[model samples]
Each structure stands twice: as C-alpha cells, then as structure tokens.
Target: MPKSLKSRGGEEELQCGPVFTVFAMGTRMTFVTEEEGINVFLNSKHVNFELAVQKPVYCTASVPKNIFFTLHEKLYITMKGKMGPFNIHQFTGKLIDELHEQLGNLGSHGIMDLNILVRDLLYPATVNTVFNKGLIPTDKGELQEFYQHFETYDEGFEYGSQMPEWLLRNWSKSKKWLLEVLEKNITHIKAYKSEKDNSVTIMQAVQDVIEMEKSELIPNYALLMLWASLSNAVPIAFWTLAFVLSHPDIHRAIKEDIASVFGSAGKDKMKVTEDELKKLPLTKWCVLEAIRLRAPGVLARKVVKAVNIMNFTIPPGDLLMVSPFWLHRNPKYFPEPELFKPERWRKANLEKHAFLDGFIGFGGGKFQCPGRWFALLEIEICLILMLYKYDCYLLDPLPKQSDLHLVGVPKPEGQCRIEYRKRI
Candidate 1:
C-alpha cells in the first residue's frame, strides 16, 4: 500500500508510512503511523509542542502573525469563564426558540437542502450565543450574504494554506468583512458596558481581555474566535441528523429516549432541560458517533525538540500529525468499527472498552477544543428539538465524504436533502 496521500494540487502528497514526510502548502509535515507512537507524541511533556497558530506556515491566509501567542491565554480564560454548562443550557434554549420560529415559518411539510437549512438554523444561534442577539443579522438577505462569505473563507482555509495571495484575494476580502463586523460589535459592546446587563456574552469577555492587553490585534483575534465558535458545528449537526434519520431503528430509539428524558409535553410546550439532556445516553451516543465518523481527520503538532518514538528518531521542527478518524475506526477499540451503534457508549461498556483513550472527537490535553462542552450541548438541543417536534426523512441517499483536505471535517460531496413535517 502507498504511504502517500495526494495533495489538492496533486503535485505534493502526504506520506503516511511508519514515519514519512510530506510537503503540504509548501510546509514539510511528518506523520506518525503507529497509534502508540502517536499517543506518546501527543501526551509527551518533553516534546514541547505548541499550538500550530504559533507558527506561520500553519496559520493559513487570513490569520495574523503571533495572534495565537497574544490571545490564547486570554481566550482560554474567557471561554472557560463564560461557556460553562449552565450558560450553554441557557443559550441553547434561546437557540431552540429561534429554530422553532424558523421551522414555523417553513411550515409543516417541505423539501429543503439539509446543509442550507441547518446552516441557517445554527449560524444565528451560534453567533447570538457567542456574541449577543444583537449581532445576529435581521435582514434575510444580509444573513444569507454573511453565510456565503463565511462559507468561502472556511472552504478556502480547508483547501490549502499555501495558495498564492492573488488566488485567495476574494477569501481575504470575505475574512476582512467578517473581522470588521466582529470589531464593530465588540466596540459597541464596550461602549455600552455600563448601560446594558450583557456580561454573559463571550464577546464581553473578549472586550475585557482586549482592554486589559491593549493589543492592536483585536480584529484578528476576534476573527479567529468567531471561527472557533461557529465552524464545524452546523456540519456536525447536519451529519447527526442525516445519520439518525437515515437509520429507522436509530431514529425511533432516539425519539423514545427523548420522550423518556423530557416526558410527553404538548407539541407547543415541549421543553428540554439541561439535566434531561445530560441524562440522554442514546442521543449523546449518536452525536458522538457522528462526530467520530465525520469530524476533522487530522490534528497537527510541530516538534519543538528532537524526540525518539518507537525506535524512530524524530528531529526538531518536523510536523507531527495524528488522525482521530483513523483511531476511531480501529477495530481493536471499537468492535464492528464501521457500523453505527450508539450502544457502544453505554455506561457499562465505556470504562470496560476504554472509550475516552481512543476517542479523539475532540483532541486531548491542553490543546483540546475549549468549546467542546458547549458544542455538545448545542448539538443535543438541536437534535432533541428536531426529533421531538417533527418527522424527518432523508430525501436523498447518504452522501459520501469528500476527501479534498488533509484536515477539517468531511463534507458531503453534494447537497443532502430532507423532508420534514410537523408530528401529528
């Protein structure tokens, strides 16, 4: 079997042999093929690997230089302080209201592109939760425009980091516009800090950090923060919905689980609480399974010091990559790895199977995604509301995952459409 995975340009390739190098977007990266070696490298204290944002080659087109160094500590503190489980529950409730309104406007029966609808539902909810409700676009056309620009910038980053500046000029423009909007919102929040009781927002925390740091890179940091909060969420939600609805038994089981947790309320009065959501084993399992199957395939780290792993001498300055997609699918950890079985996460089996050790849906250690808890909370709310309120069916076959990028979540090759009707 070939060790190399072809790059987008087709001229360059990623070598995934026991230890091989690849030039990605003009930067050399080394991938560790063995699971034990990869685990050691990830958890090693002597290896001295820092976040990729600290390096230039991995920062991509729109990111500012040294932005991570300047903002990471403050950002981590802010996320930890503001995006706790209680806050997530409150914000998710608000988002559920918004989703219900949007669904009401769409009426009982309709065929729509799943990705587009999910994007529309999640983008506003995510922005409002992270920033404030005021930041959500009021005009339908304006919201669509913002969504398009965001998609462009996200897809551009996913495509490659080494593309010529001229080729990425439009994406840069979109990023600039996004940053400007974030900056304006941040400034507005700062100016009205005394007038309004808006202390819960992540934006407010960011403003506090900016004021304390007195950094000139507010817009740049804000852009990255916004991307972190919003990206990957909608696609994850879409995949969870698609997968659950496509499997009839799984769909019925999830609905029953939701009912058991929340009880049967009136169609207009169904309420999902934080405790109920937390207690839902099957729903959580389905979401985790979806993420394991489709989330970003690779996590990259740069070696700051030479290290030896499994008898191979890894030199300083080489990039080390580990892939969750590979580990999650390893049959040793997950029996019948290719099948979608949420029961694998049953409480009795979790510890016995050592699921956490193998699960990298969110990366491990200090660099793990800060918003992961909130992400799961938001996904739970969306899935529960969706299943409880409406009958949904995939109008098209399950879309295959596109392998265009070495990192980032797998996207559907084409639009996945679904039909939804209000439950009787």
Candidate 2:
C-alpha cells in the first residue's frame, strides 16, 4: 500500500510501507494505509514558536501569541488605565450580579427588561460598527428617529426613506422591541431621558474609548452585547444538541463527565456551581470542535496605515480577513482537518498553537472579543444542561451556506427545525 501526506516543507511525499511520515513546521503526520484509504495521525514538536514569529501580520513577523497577548495586555492597560483593574473588575462584578438577579426568575416582564438591557449594551458598539462603515452624522438623526418611531412600521418606513429596505425592515422590528422595554423600565427610560442624559454621557465615555459616536451609539453598543450573546450561543446550542442526539458515544462521554463533576449534587436542578462546571472537559471539547467547524465570522482586520512589505506594498484602506475555517483545515496543521476530534485541544503543546494567527476562532490580536471568557462559560453551562437532559437532532439535513450577511456573520435560510426527546 502507498501512503501519502504533505511534508513539513509542504511537498507531497509517498511511502510504500504501511506507515508513511511527513514532517512540516515542527509537526509530523504519520499515515497508515488501509483498504478504504489512509488514516493520518499528527504529531507536533516546538517549531511553532519560530513559525509564529515568522508569520506576518501588518508586515511585522512577531510571534502570534505575543501579538495577541500584548494587544490584550495593552487593552487591559488602556481600559482600566484610568480607574484601575480592581475597580474595573468590581464594575464588571456589579453588572454580572445585576444580570444574574434579573435572569434568575425570568418572567415575560423580566425577559423584556433583559432584552432591553442587552440592547443597551449593544447600542453603542452597534452604532460604532456602522459608523465605521461610513454612516455620516446627517444620516444619524434620521436613523435615530427611525428607531424611535420603529414600532409604527409604516411611519418608520416613511421616516427612514433614505435607508436601505433591509436595514429599515431589520431596524423597524428591533426598534419596536427596544421602545417597549425602554418604556417599561425606569432605568432604560431614564438612561436616554434627554439627549444630554447619562445614557449619552455613558455613550460619550464609550466613544472616548472606542473612538466613535453616533446617535446610534446606544443601539450599536446594545447590539454588540446582544451579538456576543446570540451569535455564538444560539448556533452552539443548536449544534451541540444536534451532535448529542446523533452521536451517542459522544453523548455518553459528556454525561459521564458531567456526572463525575457534580455527582449526586444536582441531578434534577439546572444550576451547577462554577467550579463543578469547569471539570467537564469532554463537554468543553465537544463545543470547541463544533465552534472550530461552525464559527461564522472569519477574523477581520483593516489596514489602518499602509506599509511596504518585503516585495510589494498594500495601499491603505484595504481590508484583510484570516479565516480559522480554512486554517484549521490546513492538512499541514491538522491531520484530518475535517474530522471532529476534541482530544486535539487537550493534548499538551496544542494549547500553545490553538490561539495563534491561523487558529483564530474567536479572533486574534488586541481587538479580540473581551467577552470570550464569559462566552465560553455560558456555552459550557448550556451544553451541560442539554447533554445531560435531552436527545436532539436536525430535522433537516445541514443546509447549504447562504448569502444573508449580518454584520459579517452568516444567517441561516429561514427557520431550522430540530427534534428533541427527553433523555432517560
């Protein structure tokens, strides 16, 4: 039998023996030929440190982790630079407490408030995202009024004639919900009482930091927080449930891991302690694999300034995107890149490479999502509950990718149906 794999130098190599090996960038692939085809196992050494230092982003060949790590370190410095880390942590804790208390006994009213709160967090960032895309100030007032009168769909359409049809449709419904909650909640109502209120004040503070402000600030920031909650969490829950329903071995592994963590403690209750949740490694790995395969936003970078590279020059104003979807599949890095293998993450030395330039599932550099830690924890919590309690699967086969792009994230075609069964 002949076995073939890409060598470390990226050249194809063939071995007539049962096992053939290819080496590249500190990792080697050993292929064993079988009647059906070849099964390959990947092993890595320590050349990642050098490879990372050589891979260029913005024309600088710094170690990728160093770039991400340094950017985050500076973000910490700049964010808390004024108030101090302790104070920032305290503020975050306070918000977490409030959010937890509100979510604790969620009724319809509470859901409305929660939705508003999420929107408030989203508005500023959301506006900034659009504003950065060239939404001008004159456009801002009409946009604000469009959202204000959004509940009256026809009125919103009449007022927002300058906006695109899709934007108008999306915002009309969203603004109606926003107004409903803001009208109900004293906090939100007061937050934007006047153009000069604390909402604007807070928006200015955010603007000072993020460097943009439109009347859309509140809505945009609210959208940012909402995206963090919805974009990853929703899809992850769907896939986790689908995979658990279809893969019993994986399901059993997750259940056993969860059981071992909170044994006899909370069999019936949905709540588990944070420490106990961290012990579910198998569950974490399942979600990681799912996200690696399914994450929608390819990491985005815009050239803020132009520079000359070794051979050529990229002019300023060019946008650059690096996708983990492809990089994660590069046969040189992952031996069966398409296979769902969670253990790859748990294996030592893998962590060192997981967050590098090519492996940016959550994005990379200073601008990477600050809420990643919270996002991961939330995902783990939700996955544990679903894996422990329900059996689920896709009602339809995996749909082909579509053209609907929301803030660079993909939207599924219409609605997806899934079948769920109670697990015994």
Candidate 3:
C-alpha cells in the first residue's frame, strides 16, 4: 500500500485504493511542481473521508478497482428510478420540442427567454422528484434558505455568479411545490434514516437525509442531482446532433444502423425499446465519441485537512482541481486525440482511455453522480429518435465547444439552432 496523503492532523485517509488523496479548503500550497504541471501531494497524513470542505494537499490518489465497485454500490443505492422527475423525460424529449416551438415563435433573441422556459420546465420537476421521495419542503422560504446556505458553502460552483444564481432562482420558484409533497409523505421518508440499515429503501434514505439537513445537504443534494443528470446530456445532445448533421459518414452509418434495427422508409414514428436500443451500437459509439470530443469538464475535490508532500508540508484547508478534459484528450491514451472516431470503442481497444476507472464523465468513487444510468439511457433514446425522425443540421458554419462551468457540463456557446425537416 503506497503511503497516500494524510490530513494535517494525521487522521484517516481518503482511501483511493493504496494511493490516497486528500482535499481541504484554504490550505496554501503550490499548485504545481517544476516538473509536474500540478504537484499532487500523493501521500498526506491528514486526509479524511469527508468531502474535503477545503483544499488539502493536491495529489494523485491511486484509485483501485474497488473504488469503482464502491461507486456501483452507491449509485444503485442513491439513484435508480428517480430520474423521471428531474425532467429527463421532459427536458430530453418535450422540452426540446418546446424549445424548437419557442424559437419558432420567439426567434433568435429567444436565448434570453430560454433561461426562463428551461428553468420553468426543469426546476419544478427537479424539486418534485426529491420532494415526492419526501426529501424536503418545496416551500419558497425553505428553498430560499436552502439556496442561501448552499451558495455560501458548496464548492461545486467555481464561477459563483454564473451557476449559483441560476440554481437559486429556479429553486426559489419551485420551493412551495416541493414542500407540499414532503408534507404529504413524511412518514415514508423517515423510515430509511438509519445508516446502519444498509437495506433501507433508497427513497427513504434520501428523504431522511433532507429532513435531517434541511439547511445544506438536502437542497444542494437535490439540485446537484439535477445538475449531474442533465449537465452532460444536454451539451452532449447538442454536439452529437451537430456531428450528425455535419459529418456525412457518421450520418450515413447511423441511418443505416437505424434502418437495419427498425426499417427504411414510411415508418417515421418509432419508440426505441431497450432491445432495439441495444442494436444501435454504432449510434451509441457515435454519442460516446462526441462526449469525448466536447465534454471535458473539471472535477474539484476539497481537502478536509492537510499533510505533507515530499519535503514540504501543506497545511489544512485547500482545494485540488482535476481536469478530465485534459486526461480524456491525452494523445497517449487516445491516439490522434483530436479525431472523432467511434471505432475506438470496439473490443480491440477495449482497454483504451483508461477503463471504467479513468472516465470522469460520471465521476468515480463513492461520491460519483448517482443518475448516470438514467443519463446514458436518456441520451441513447434521444439520439436514436433525432437521427431517425428528422434530418437536422447546425445553422453555424463552425461548431464551437459548449461552455460548461465544470467539465462535461456543456452549454452551447451560441443559441444552438438546428434546421429540421421530417425525414420522408
């Protein structure tokens, strides 16, 4: 076991397999060494298990396969069927249609208005998803309070002004509905509060958590679920669509795949079943490739305490930022890093780009996002439908990377408009 970084007080470790990583806040340490772009303090004595509230020592922790195993356990425990409320159904399907209709009515400047429509459809659905599970009061006051505390505490926001404001505003509006749901179903949520009861129903645990931390954890956790579930899917959809429209080869391959799976002409309306979805392997690979090219948001961990790095000692309270954007695009792992090739995912290079281990799109460890399965399913369904139902193209000549505050959280730079004509 490699001596992983420890907290300043020499407490427990992050336990990323043998190589531990510590993150804390306000720990003043040089970000990078002369040789390493960021001098990650691999082993610090003070590291703890808590989501590092601040920066600890920046170091690359050896994440074992067990971390992934733990993540799978946590993911199943946290999010399984709860995605319907996060507007995955609406945002991925109806909302896109609504946005298209809205654009038809409102036109280009509708981008400003979109900030409203998107929130209207998204926030309430998100709050209710949690509230229905007995998570929190969706009341305006409760939500406002929740928003206030999260803004002050949670480190997810690197650009406070850009992301938090949007999150808070939507939260404020949806609070009342959320509260009503919680009030209606309080008893069921309480049943799952005990941590000792590993078999506790996930919904109950979620509710118990919110009920316990009405202040920070519940509200932010609810919102974070929404962000994690949708953040990559939306931008991924935008880019994937753009790619389909621009790349004739990809378009042809996908069309062939779709036709082979279902049929060729006349059958315009097709609801993709789980089995039919399995057949669209090429389409799935294309979506994956698009994510590789466009979705590379950053992940940050706060150090709960501090420890030592080499000869130098790092005090407690600091943050470590890792960019999977760089890792995902590394030429060493992905040959011709800039190229968009779905063939890479085939069995020959199955070990390429780091296994289920290095991929940060859904994150890793116990703290990884829970709704990844939902997100992936939703992406697959949406892409399948778009490719089948219509011929679409990007209005702009040069498609640019979407602006996601964090890695994989992508928002198109311009109002991403696609000219769609029914495939006849």
Candidate 4:
C-alpha cells in the first residue's frame, strides 16, 4: 500500500478519505490531514517518535538493537543541546568559512548543478561544524564525494526500512562507507582531542555520552546525527534558494534586505552576525514557504498508548502518519494552498512563529526537530551569501521533487543548472 502511494504521483493517492488507512507488510497505519486528527497526530502523548522511526533508523544505520532505544533518546537530547542557539552561535563563522570555501571553487561565471552546489556547500559545513577538522576531509571535492555516497545510501532508505538490509548489498556498502568514516572521526576525537585544539564538536559531544566498551555504537550514533542534520536540510536549502531565485521580486527584495543588514556585497567576504541574521524577515519567510511546499509528505509515529483521533481509536501498536505537504495546502490556514507566497506567513495564525493550524514544516509539539533553528539559519545563510556574493539565476527550469518519495525533503527530480556571475 505504501508502494502504491509511492509509485503513484501527486495528491490523489493521499486524498482518499477523512482518515486514510494503509496495510503494508503486516503494519497497520492511519494517515491524518484534518484539523483535530492532525493535532492529535502531532501532539498526542501516545505518539512515539523514536519507536516509529526505529525501523528505518535501525535498518539503514549500523546501530545495534540492544542499545537503539537508549542511544536514540540520548542522542536526541545531544543534538538538541549541541544545535541549540548557543552552540550554533559559536560555529556560525566557521560554517560560513566552509560555505565560502566551496563557493570559491566555482569561478566567476559558470553553469553549475544547483543540487551539487547545495551538497558541496552544506555537507562540508555540517560535517566540519559538528566534527573536528581532521575527522573528515575538509576539501570541497572530497566532501562532494562523501555526499554522493550518502545519496546512494539515502536513496534506498525507505525500501531498506521495509525490507531486510542483506537484500540490498550495494546500499549496505554505502552505509558501511559512511559508518567507517564516522567511526574514525569519533575514535580520533576521543583519543587525541585533548592533545590538539580541544575544541568540542557535536560528534565530540556524541562521543561523551556513549560508553567506552560499547565502541561499535560510536559511528552508528554519528551516522544518525549526520543523517538528521544534513539529509533533509541539504535539499531544503536547494528548494529554498530555487524558490527565491524563481521569484524575481522575492529574490530582489531579500537581497536588498540582507544588504541593508550586512552592508553592500563586494569581493570581500560577508561578515554575518546572529543579531543581523535575526533581522531578516523576508529571507526567513522564503525559506518557510519553500519548506511548506516541499516538506516530507509523510511522517509516521507509533501509537504507543491508545489515542482517539478523527473518530477512530488508534491502538497501542499502530502507526500514525501526517503529511505536511497536504496539511500546508489547506486553504483555511494558508489561504492559497499551492502558490508560493512568503508574505502569507505575515497573516497566518502564529504563536511563537508557528502556524497554529495546518502547517508543521519543522514539525510540531515538544518533539519538533531539534535542529529546527539551525536548519533555518543554515538555509538563510546560504540564501544571503549566494544572493549577496553573486548574481544567480536558474539556467534551466526549477527542478521538481521526485513524487515517488515522501519521507523527508524530497530531492530534485533532475539537475537544475544555475548560471551565476560573481559580484564585482
């Protein structure tokens, strides 16, 4: 049934009933899109985030079953603590240096795949920011290759989750490659961190929580963090920049806004500050709008305890799923369900910048993505830097999302080439 939904493109498959039901491989799942059901799906104490994600998290990663529950919950807190504003503020400048380093490799005028550019920029910034310098190769070309392997591993994630890992040998290899690298990074940091820079990394924090004898779990946990931090955020970055560049008005307005805060764009590097980054409403809105349109089509959580939603009583063992793609399309909350209007955010019913109804791009409730602010800030930084340092326009039509996948930020269906000239 999930395959049927994945094989078929567009909304018709998702619009079947008030509460859609799917029976796949002995798993019973209920999908919710309406107001009450959606709230319960997101906010219900019965919904279990770790358990729902356990299948995929275990399948794709090397994390052993015995420690999955403890490691998953512990790392959730680790990620939240490591990516919170204080940690992010410290790494902002370093992350920008990584981004600029990649940009430097792209000459003054060229046609480049926007997807590749996003991967090249974000993969290194995230890896280097969360890991020590020598932990992973910091060179742009090496990082690009690293992300390519991750794409291969990620491409088979859903299928791997549903089926056995041994069935997919090649995907398994990619996973191994990633884990090996992560393992080396963790081991090196733990062994030599005190002798060297002694600067703490996210992965360093991760290494601390895990037991010394349970060393096999190090890379597995590191892999989990890498996937959470980069997998969706990278594509979301692509979509955000693509959306803004597609709308000339929005692009120009955000450019001017960033300039007012960061000063005029020149050959010199951008001097970004957290306070200045906070001043960008338009840039922030465009990122939100892109996320609204291209967010994960389905997010499934386990119905741990019995919960009533949309007239149905979800039992303890069932799965509850929500579609941010369809939810954000509701005209009641978003007005124009399909159109990309960054300004709609200004008029929505928002508490603490979250839409009370219909929207859950960063997710909702206490279990919202811990890297939410960092992800947004990362996207916005990319937008401002690219927009400020270069005059970029899509050389081809904006790429569309692969309708076949629904788990996370969908990768572009094809390459969208962008031609940019470095600002004088």
Best by TM-score: 4
| Candidate 1 segments exceeding 4 Å error | 1-16, 48-51, 55-67, 84-87, 191-199, 263-266, 347-355
Which lDDT tens digits does candidate 3 get at residues 157-244?
3433223334554433443333343344555544434333344443444544445434223333334443444445555666666666
In the order shown, what is each candidate's alpha-carbon RMSD? 3.8, 13.7, 11.3, 3.3
| Best-to-worst ranking by TM-score | 4, 1, 3, 2
Two-way lDDT contest, 1 vs 4, winner? 4
- Overall lDDT per candidate, in order of appearance: 0.70, 0.41, 0.47, 0.77
* Model 2 / residue 228 / CA error / Å: 3.5
For 209-235, candidate 4 gives per-residue lDDT tens digits of 776437668778777777888889898
Q: How close is candidate 3 to the true structure, as a TM-score?
A: 0.58
Q: What's the lDDT for residue 251 in model 4?
A: 86
Clashes of each: 0, 24, 51, 0
For each candidate, give its TM-score against the true structure: 0.88, 0.53, 0.58, 0.91
* Candidate with better lDDT, 1 vs 2: 1
> After superposition, which runs of candidate 2 have C-alpha atoms over 4 Å from their true positions?
1-220, 264-266, 308-310, 348-357, 393-403, 406-416
Candidate ranking (lDDT, best to worst): 4, 1, 3, 2
- Please give the distance, in angstroms, between residue 27's alpha carbon in candidate 2 and its true position after superposition: 39
Query: Which candidate ranks first by lDDT, i.e. highest?
Result: 4
Q: Of the candidates numbered 2 and 4, which has the greater lDDT value?
A: 4
